[model samples]
Target chain A: DAGITQSPRHKVTETGTPVTLRCHQTENHRYMYWYRQDPGHGLRLIHYSYGVKDTDKGEVSDGYSVSRSKTEDFLLTLESATSSQTSVYFCAISESPGTSRYNEQFFGPGTRLTVL
Target chain B: AQTVTQSQPEMSVQEAETVTLSCTYDTSESDYYLFWYKQPPSRQMILVIRQEAYKQQNATENRFSVNFQKAAKSFSLKISDSQLGDAAMYFCDRTGNTPLVFGKGTRLSVIA
Candidate 1:
């Protein structure tokens, strides 16, 4: 499929442990984002990258970290996992041309992370 | 900051019938985009339809269409001849330089 794939569809980790979620895209998009979804808060952005090695934080970047060392892969790391970090994480990519509105985002199946 | 709102938490429609899900948003930027995403039990976020802010024409994809009221800052989704496959959580989103801001989502139930 010409889409994005997220590793470890489901994971359970202990508190204070370091966990990393990987997002790989075959579409070669310029923009990649990490978002977490909870029950009533909809989906909140954690981090996003405009290009390779160019990234910025979103509204919810407190305990999360992200890296976009290459164009095809974006990794999100939980420095120290907390129970509050337990949520469904999603990776999205957009192929917006120069104007940055050329295409909509494509999301992966999402990784269900449970912090114990 | 932009915010998307889906007032109806849940909705139900009979098969072959029509149903509309309401979405409201607040954005100061005039040039942006709106989208509807569907997440089924499989947990895959699928793009149902999209609308460019500058365009006046409504976007339609198969049985899915959008009634976009830009002046009102309201965008609602209409499903014509709803099917069982339409049962999923539908989310309205607004996008700009920032990542897409999504609504809480409305879970739709298709009764056959």
Candidate 2:
């Protein structure tokens, strides 16, 4: 198991409020990604970071923002939470293709957020 | 864009029996990767198996094996000696230069 952890394992916020979730990894992997899991959707990428201060949007980047100021930490923020944004958010880390060609991401436990 | 499809929403297998879950993907690129991930009741995502497009032989890990057909763009997972612990939601994913595209998932049940 990769040494990855997500903060605020569970959170609740009212609609129109701001919320943030944090992901930390001890492995010092170069790739970090944020995803969300909903009832009908298995998992959708929200954002990804290849390095500190470098980030890109994903398939479902609406209503979400992410920042990676450090190698070990990636933050996902919801400027104004909406009911549709309530879902289980997961953080993943992966190393670039090197000696081992299989580049699979290691996931954190995940953060369950609810918007009222 | 790549799209992964899991036709079976749910499936069941008796203890000790073997079962196969279906996954099909559409992509224009030949160099890519296919993956199967298991999410048990704990919601932990476990990498069951992965297949590299360049590899002709199917990828196998213990009881988990994948039947990958490049022509048909199909990748199916076969589980042998099914145990209750094997029961979980299975997701099929595909990736190349882009982020992973996942199927909705198939709920697997193992009956004693």
Candidate 3:
């Protein structure tokens, strides 16, 4: 798991509720990413942070917001959860992008969110 | 935008046999990276192999190898001596200046 941990491994929430998932890393990597996995879709990046307070949106960034106040922690917030937002979320960390020799992303176990 | 395509949605192979998973991508960048990641029932993403667009030689790791055709915009993974543990969901992805764009994924089943 590359010293990465995601809180709330499983959560069942109702629609219109607010949900926040936390990702913590001990590796102190410079990059952190939030991705969602669903049927028919392998993994789609929701958001990523290159450095503290430097975050960017991904292809599927709508309805999702991210914050990285610290290097080790990256948080994903669903302002108002919806049924479509129910999926398995994964957190990944990497020392750098493709330029680094250790460019591979290390993923956490994952957090399963179910919205009714 | 970079897009990865995995043509096969599902494939099955007998134990000790060999199987090839096909993946193709559309990228305009000359310098990029391609990767194959595996996710078993545990749901943990594991890196199987990677290929640099600048490298002409294929990348191999033990029984796992890749056939990278930079000009053809194709990268395929070849697994030799398949085992039960090899059964999993495999995703193909490419990265350039932005985050990795992944394929829909292919499910592999290994039968003994």
Candidate 4:
């Protein structure tokens, strides 16, 4: 455990409803990312933040939004949940990209989200 | 676009046996990084090993080592003396300026 916790470890929501998943870290890492895993797709980056209030979209950013108000917390929100959004979501953090260490991503326990 | 391909969808190896999982990636960038991540049933992602594209020597970590063939665009992981704990989904990944691009993953079964 990297002192990372994801709220609502398991979430079940119906289509057209709003849902939010939270990720909290105790390490004060500067970089945070949200990824979703599905069969045959491996893991796809949904969104990532390099600093507070600064975020970027990843390969699969559509249908998902993210916010990082503080270094310790990053939130992923689905404005209107859809069945296509059902998957296991994972949160990862790493040292800033240029600080010498690369490819060292620490992951959270993961959240299983199901959309009906 | 960068893509990673893990040919083996499922593989089984007996305890104390050696097994190799194949991974091939396609990228135009000459300088990048390759990685192997393990996900047990627990669903936590663990780093197994990593290889810098510029490095010719294969990276090794205890019981886990990689056979990195840069010319062939292949990076395979070999686990020696397999243990039951080795059973899990192994994912091959690539990273550069963008986030990592992961392969579909190979489910490895360690039979006792």
iRMSD, all candidates: 2.4, 3.1, 1.0, 2.2
Q: Pick the candidate with the highest lDDT.
A: 3
User: DockQ of every model listed?
Assistant: 0.58, 0.51, 0.78, 0.60
Candidate 1's residue-wise lDDT over A34-98, tens digit each? 99999988888899998999999998999999899899999999999999999999999988832
| Per-residue lDDT over B51-93 for candidate 3, one digit per residue giving the tens place of the 0 to 100 score | 8888999999999999999989999999999999999999999
Candidate 4 TM-score, C-alpha based:
0.96
- Model 4 agreement with the true structure over B29-71: per-residue lDDT tens digits: 7778888999999999999998988899999999999999999
lDDT of 4 by residue, A1-116 (tens): 57889998999999999999999999989899999999988999999999999999999999999999999999999999999999999999987552234657889999999999
Question: What is candidate 2's lDDT per residue for B31-108, written digit by digit as tens?
Answer: 788899999989889999989998999999999999999999999999999999999999999877887788999999
lDDT of 1 at B105: 95
Worst 10 residues of 4 chain A by lDDT: A95-104
Model 4 lDDT at residue B5: 96
Question: What local lDDT does model 3 show for residue B18?
Answer: 100
Model 1 chain A TM-score equals 0.94
RMSD of each: 1.3, 1.5, 0.8, 1.3
Docking class of 1: medium
Q: Of models 2 and 4, which has the larger DockQ?
A: 4
Q: Which stretches of candidate 2 lie over 4 Å from their true place?
A: A97-100
For A1-116, candidate 3 gives per-residue lDDT tens digits of: 48999999999999999999999999999999999999998899999999999999998999999999999999999999999999999999999886556778999999999999
Residue-wise C-alpha lDDT for candidate 2, range A1-116, written one tens digit per residue: 89999999999999999999999999989989999999878999999998999899999999999999999999999999999998999998888631236579788999999999
